[model samples]
Target: MQCPQIVEPEKSTQARRHALWSTCSPPHQRNSPMATTCPARARVPLTLQRSHVCQCVFIRSPARVGAVVSRAEASTAERRKTAVNMRTPRRRRHRSLTATAAATAAIAALSTSAVAPALASDQPPVNIVEMTPELTKKMQHEVDTFFAKHDLPGLSVAVVTPARAGSDPVITTFVAGTPTLGSSELVDATTQFELGSETKVFTADLLAYLVATDRVSLDDPVQLFAPAGVEVPEWTDPQTGATTAITLGDLATHQAGLLDAPPNLGAGCGADPGCENPRPGYTQTMLWDAFAQPCLNGQPCPMYQPGTDWLYSDWGFGLLGTILANVLDPVIETEPPAYQSALDQAFLDALGMSSTELEFHGDGRLATPYKADGTNAFHWDNTNAISGAGGLISDATDMGTWVAAHLGYVPSTAPIGVQAMADTLQPISDITMSCSIPDQCGPAHFQMGLGWELHHAATHDVGAAWAFKNGLTDGSSTDTALAPSLRVGVTTMYNKRLSDTDQGLPLAITLLKLLVADQPAPEPAPSAAPQAALAESGQPTAELIVPGMMAAGFVAIGLLLIIRRRGHGRRSTR
Candidate 1:
């Protein structure tokens, strides 16, 4: 068979630009040196791989330009699978590859097949699970209805279907409405959105990681990791006449009787002698100062005895980050802020979250935030002491990986990956109760996990386990939810600052329930990339399932076989 040839475009100017952009960065911009060789398999705790994981199948095929499928053989698939499943890259090779962004995107599009391997150290695996047509229509309707009525500018939601063999975590993403601010680009998988307080979950996860390794104890008093020279103004039990030290669990569960923030909130860093924010990007310093000056108006601030209260305090989390950073600094041997670097190691680097980062300023891209009134809102950043409170910047794609790990599906090579996830999901306190048993419990009854808030009664009624953390920021709102047993999680985010009556939280729950419905999943997966005949004409078309290319190839081969048989019959007649 002969194929048509395409002509090449003039490359005079393009060649010059490509050469310029491909050049390596200077010494100052280069990433820290990492080992030239990687280990065969990073040592992961045995506990990380208990059960229910959908191991990603890595198929290394020839990625044709302008194509979505790759053609590779058994040996190539094994090698690529080893890179992702066995050995997790120790550190990322941050390079001066700015010019290669487009080139990289082109290659990535080819690897969007279900078995695309995340071989490049910097590239997190991309998994696309084409959902049922009816499911797509249903989710789109829900997304559109919320955006239309709520006056939200833009929103992105990603759902993970029940995992099946021969695939990575089955992910389906929906981008709805045009963003009111920033580049006005359509909200998609790669777009970075502020994680808001959902960051606390990561912070709590870090603590759990440490606790799992015996490096720290959740029951230890807060003073254990406090910076030297900063005195934790003790709160004594009047009846016992002994100081009631604040334990780490108190902060993780929000049971610590601490203020939401010190002195001023949402104000710029002030140079005055007494200001909540004294310096930019100095969360640890500010956290230490808050405790050192744990008094207001020359008197100790109001703080109920530790473990007796359940007030949500961002500053309390800031203090926790400072403590965790101090403990993790020596262990990781990092020059950056200890806690921040530790987080990068556990999640961004080791756990394979390529699209996530701690800070946003001077970063590549950001989804602009807006107010409910359709006006621009300030882009809230967690540069100050409150980063542990809400400093994470991530996309729905990265969040899907995170969701998988928490659901005990995709375990990481990190020492405490699976254990930390379980610990974070454990219930710790009560938030509000359900209305199911009005006679036994009041309507305002709910449960709070280490980082996630538990939703029982209603969720249990549907035979699903649900938990979530609603993130609130001045410029953005984020809702992160989980359905553990059903193995589905969702992240709904909008640049718009949701007001009092916002439906973003409920919207996430509704979509999540639909994703993890009680009905059994179709064998393999019913969804595949739309074929020409099926997408175009109304005909009985073959479904190109999981690895979209294989099914397409089968259909093509069948038609060709019929053609050859007809040709032979004609020759026989002659």
Candidate 2:
């Protein structure tokens, strides 16, 4: 029952390192490289419904305990400490060590190698989700339930599993509903949906690719890439009266101390309050104005010292897009397209994300966004400057490929190096969330990776972590979650922008847990009160509410009749 001790190859050859790092599920007795190291465990049935999942890692130790970690575990711990410390301005480099080689090696050695064999363990067997009649019906049933229960206009989902022996990585995709309510056409793999802030991950991916290629550095000042006459904001510590310039790392991790949105986002709004929308996008001139003086009181004021705290800011990411555009424009041969073209060249195109784009020029494939009431909703338009903040439009297939790449499933066609994708998942800053009940939070830790939200469950091996991101626009929403150790990635796309209280997030998170650990999903604890709120208020449908209202009305009528009868009896007695 004991997992055998794995002996690291002395040479650490490229192939050996790859084999050591490519674990997807629990150990199997055949085919998988990990089968030789980790033995089998009993299978656990999934108990949680599709709507109760939260962001947590489920790691089941092999049948035996006391397994020794590989050599890389110590170095990874040191690097994580260093990466966390680097968030301070005193140590501003902010680059973590590359993917933990030994920790991954140990995980690979401990995990079941083949996807099918994972069925024998407490892990659901990772299978390729195709558009077969059976799978389509199953997915459609789930999608219909969500639509009826949660008010979703439409949905498309994709999940990626690591490759099994003699097989390619398994990608599962399913779509239900139409681009618009009246349209007869149902959404498919190619139908594009606005990604919203999910675009930030792509921006971060571009940054990582550039850094991996040595075209940029994490510590590079935002000022370095700005076009002439454009100024980058400076942060002044109010108490210390010391100042520092924001760097790309600070921007990527939301520690740049910038406002959530640029002040000029409402520029030229005149009297129309609704004109404040960023969907029209920020122009270069407006972007420059904000950068020159972020606070607009003739001051380049930042809320706090750069690199000192975490504050999610669309303005910061917008500025990042501008910087990346500046860095990429010189290298572009023809008239520079939207900054997205650079992203296409960097990874999207290479990774088979042909349907993903920042700009939609009458693409027939673009899904019609809808409101909760099934009415048409506005699709966000992005200018080059703010495109990276929340502008990319993508489909389930492309999103799946992007998530798969993070788990070391980069296809040979992808010229972009795997290290580039890995770099984006590196935890750069520790994120402390306020939990009313700290113990309920368990040993789960949170961090800001390049653009991903990193969640580490109780595991000594830092490599065993999950990274995820959520996106929302006026009309649509997207959620993507990945567990690299299990090589599992799950994403959901909705035509309607579901509320935070909706089941969209819980569904994705729950699906991930089901795949990663087949054990019954625990209910959301007090720490996940928001998730608990989902059961009560998350997009209740008319079918659920109308009957209750009818019952209440019937009861009220009966009470009124009783009162009238009592009054009649009193009059008779008189």
Candidate 3:
């Protein structure tokens, strides 16, 4: 290395060359000397090259180093300036980040909140029940069996539970028979049948509605509302000689001493040669006049004192209906209209029972009334003055709506309580029947309510307690029953005019029992304090209850899972 002396280039020349090389050199090799030794042919044009390379090199070296130093200083100053800028508003920067995070979280929270209900909507609704395949099949089978056994031409039945807030009721329908005996038109749930005495229930309800609205008072004397100069027959107390007036309650409760049917209903009769009009021809006015007559001369008397006993009297109910019409006329602003017709539209229409009505039009949809012998030939007579007692025509679907309303399962148009309806369904009288003639009577105990019949000790052995009513006319037999204990209700409308001994009522009972066969026993009544203490002390109470058992089971399962997870965590740690 000491063999030759290496003279350093002059500062100006070195600087000049450095400048020239700095322009040509790649950024990575700018400091290397070998970058300058390229051939002239490989070099850039001399004009474009550095003029006076030695001088250029000498001038540019310090300038290049200074420029580098200046750049480094500027970069350091920029970094310091950035650091200062960052430190000056440290709290503000932190606050900004925190605010941004909070804003982002709030936005995310809002989005999540909005998305939850949408997701819930997307999911299937809860608390809804679909008819199980087994239930459907059983219902169908039962309906078919009934048709086959009864030799029905066509029949349709609709069973509905009370509707829930956001869910429709479980409506199970079966259509098995034809609408007409000859036409083979399939019957559907919309098929209409005369409701018969079932109309009495609606009429009674309307009367109750009027009473509820203060349109009429139950204790108001019927004579007050009776047509002008129409004297309502009165009953006199034998001891007091005081005239007893019949009240609206007497008529409604069937204690008005009215006859079961019109008096001398079949009076005008003669031999075929000298024929007279038969079938008691009593008009509404005539019935009212007869009611005005004294039981004996100059004394007001009734069969029994008002509200003394309950008798099944169509006349009593008829008078009640007439009074209801009079009371409702002024309030509804429809004077002298058919009271039954107005009641149907006001209450039933609002409830969405579009298929119900007070009259049957002979459209193809109306089911023909028949006799018990399955004879389609039957008279379709007007209900006359007693229309309110037995004139409504409805189908199973519409009846279900009415039942739901009675059960407080549907909102009522009139402000009446379920207790009021229940009161109407209570037993007001004891009806004893003789079994001498099977068609005429049977061994039955009937308790009469306002419009309901309480059947005690029914044939069925399921301990059936029912609020029932039956309607029998020339060609139609209709029955409706509600079993509150079992939470079941039924409506059976037969086109045929069936006797009390016919299969309609029995069939309805049997079907109702079957429908409720699987219902759980109702909850046991709460024990008395002593009984409760005994139960707590492990002594037998009246009932052994499983209170909160399901909830306890779920809690136990959750605890077990938690314990197992803890055990697993301990084992894994080990």
Candidate 4:
């Protein structure tokens, strides 16, 4: 049957009628709000799984039904008015607007009233993540299990919630385990730890900020901006046998044809004797030399032509950092050299990343890295070479704020920073991925964005679902991810290094699922039957549609009156 907006009848009476219908109707006929909760699926013959069974519901006596529905709706409207009249009323603000503002507001209202209906796609998914004692208890147990599985010294996670009306955004900072095995120092959100490649997001964003300022274009050739005496190399793709122009954008998107690590990188007592060690760093000269060298592994990057292959390369970002450091040139005055100091000013200080140090400042507050056996290791730092790629330290709290800024949940950061964050989330590279077409079911299939990895559950658009970056060093593991559409961000830092940060991924994914997943379908409605039936059918009832329709009509009428009056004034003057 066609979906027609029917007047809502008396809630309880309607419920009784619907309940009778539901009890008698064939098992396949009842409406289900979500496929996940549908009972009809159980009755489906296994052989007929590929086919869909649609039960069409039809009602006779249209005139009689309409008459009853109209009268019930009238009574409901009256009861609503009576309730409003019984309540204490507050003064509503009605302000006179300037001529320009009035005209602008009228145009805006006209556009919104006219356009919003056509664009409404997803139902404004009700996202009520309960932080009840029971929920917290379960979450804590999961967190404990995750830490135990990884044998982490400690783990801290910060979840920034979506903003609600009349309430500030909520941040739940949960910390578990010990910062050190022998010591009693417990890790918390405030505990400092190296964020590693998570810093690359900021470096990529700095390039975006410069673009927004018209200082540089993403299309600018990397060779034009590389530091003096540093030379980035050319890559001839073995598969395609074509050389492509590399740009700053390529570096940001991991398409700059660079190796995974700088060439000359080795383990177990190298020529310089620090190569195999966990804390070794390189200078700008070393970085340039490494970029000029050939690829060590056969994955991609310097091994392949730019944009022809997708390779996760820290060396690509190292090139980007060199360009940014030279192009920006000590935007902040700090004890560090020109390049590092510029990075500090442009991002670290600008983002209020006080807890994130550009280099090891000998700060005792740093989280001590622990060996798998739980013995202490020297905290990792960076030299000018690799520091730009994965050399920044941050805590869970600041990382959350960084995520918040990226998702545009916070306006405290610089506007350029916001733009850059948005820019970085744009999916640019594609993995060898194939998904269920048309409706888009299946795993994310691993898409790449500028300095970020994108989770494409809903859409492939930048910031549509989640944008993420993860980091791992010999000392720590960190993951930062944001879902802009849901206005949620998750960040975690752990003292012990892990081969995989899948433990933290589950926590972050769980939080996001709570934000985006459809509400429990089988749950009874807060209102009685009429409204519940409408909701379950995916059809907005007359009662729900009428108020909005009325409001828009009223606003449009007001706008017409104002515009006419303004036109009259202008004509009279003329």
Backbone clash tally for model 3?
A: 21
| Cα-based lDDT for every prediction | 0.56, 0.59, 0.51, 0.55
What's each prediction's TM-score?
A: 0.62, 0.62, 0.58, 0.62
- lDDT per residue for candidate 3 within 472-552, as digits (tens), equals 666666666676544456666656665456464345565565555534355544333555565676745322323333344
Residue-level lDDT of model 2, residues 1-574, one tens digit each, is 2332332222211111111111122223335332232221111101111121101112222221112222233465588999875464322212111123333343434332211112234433333222233433444456567656876666778766543331235555556677777778777666688888998988898888777666788899988876677777687667897779989998998878777778777652435766635545446666667765546444555665777656678888887876776666543312233576667556654443555777484947788877656677777776456778988888765676577667765433334433378778888988653222212222225788999988874332223367778888878888888877667778888878665566434456655654555322444332323433434665334444455555555555565566556546755885
lDDT of 4 by residue, 1-574 (tens): 1222222222231121110010012112235321112122111010001111111121222232222222323565698999765543121112223444565566556544432334334433444342333444455566677777787777887666543231223445567766667677677555678777887887877776677656788888877865567665666656886766788877887766565676654421236654445224455555556655556534433554566555667777866776677666742211223545555444444343455656464745567786555666555565455566877887664565566556654333233434356666777777552222212324336667778877776543332367777877667777776776556666878877654434344455554554444222434434334556656767555555556556666666676677667556755885
Minimum summed lDDT over a 10-residue window in model 3 is located at 50-59
lDDT of 1 by residue, 266-353 (tens): 3345455554333244545555566655444544533666765456777778667767766766422112246566675444444445
Candidate 1 displacement at residue 95 in angstroms: 53
What is the total number of backbone clashes in candidate 2?
2
Candidate 4 runs further than 4 Å off: 1-135, 166-168, 228-231, 236-242, 266-281, 297-301, 330-340, 412-414, 433-444, 458-464, 499-507, 514-574
In angstroms, the error of model 2 at 407 is 0.9
Error of 2 at 369 (Å): 1.1
